[model samples]
Target: MACAWEESTKIRDVLIRPGTENDCNTIMDLIRELASFQGYPYAPQITAEILRRDGFGDNQQASFQTLLAVDRTTDKIIGYAVFFPFYSTWRGKGMFLEDLYVKPAHRKLGIGKLLLAHVSKRTLDSGGCQLRLSVLKTNPAKMFYSSLGFDNLTVDDGWETGRLDTNALEHLLESSGLTRS
Candidate 1:
């Protein structure tokens, strides 16, 4: 899909489309940009190689989907959104929006909203009702999401999010002493 926006009274066109393997490098760059913007400049461990293998390898059972917004004038990607499906024990199925980012120069032009709307449609198309994402308490995007009717799980439903990294997960499994038959 394409959107036309007037930024600074200058009309610009942007195209949003499904990402391909050829976009791995650009996707990684955007991921890094997002990490930096979120105050974790070094948090992104993804490389083009990893992205290719996990997202677009020959297996074709990719774990995620990415949508890119390319500026029509320059034909350069200015924004992207990454998402995947996950099962919620209560809801049965849901969508996790891993990242939604627009270049600093492209904000306020509805790119983020367009990406979000697309993902919401994808979620509904897949029979999902919940779309989950995490926002830092200090991040101003929290207010934007609230304005869009996204409720804070902790405050609204007392839901606590948890995570385990590779090392911690390995340690937990070792301590559990479980073995395959």
Candidate 2:
């Protein structure tokens, strides 16, 4: 299914539209750029093929959705937002924004906000009550998000984010004798 933002949603010359399989490569590039900008200790493991398979493949329903911000004059992808739906026991339905990124050259142009607004609108349209995301402690975008009404759960609710990498997950599964079917 094609996702489209209303014509009135355009910001300056940037247009937000649904991403397709053909956009996977560009999307992967942007993801890498974001990782680099954030000074990640390790490079991203995701590849264009993986993105295409999981997000635009013919075999199964898309696990996530993406929206691309394109510069109308150049028709180049300057940014993108990836999101997926999740159920929150306390809030009912919610949308988790996995990533929101814009090229350094494109910053402060309102593209990022426009993309986020589009995602928020989509979440609401789908019967979702909240939009959530996690940002690095040092990312300056935290202020931007705050200005847009995103609450920092860590500060407000004393929540701490946790994760287990592939190796740890494998070790846990082995210790628990959990075999993948």
Candidate 1 structure lDDT: 0.87
**What is the TM-score of each predicted model, taking all chains together?**
0.88, 0.89
Write candidate 2's Cα lDDT for 1-181 as tens digits: 1223433344668989999999999999999888888898358887899999999999899999999999998999999999999899998999999999999988876789999999999999999999999999899999999999988899989999899999999999999999767
Local distance difference test, per candidate? Answer: 0.87, 0.91
Alpha carbon deviation, residue 22, candidate 1 (Å): 0.6
Which candidate number maximizes TM-score? 2
Q: In candidate 1, what are the lDDT values of residues 46-159, reduced to their tens digit? A: 789999899898977998999998888899999999999989887788899999999999887777887898899999999999899988888878887898899798888898
Lowest lDDT 10-residue stretch of candidate 1: 1-10
Q: What is the TM-score of candidate 1?
A: 0.88
Report clash pairs, candidate 1. Answer: none
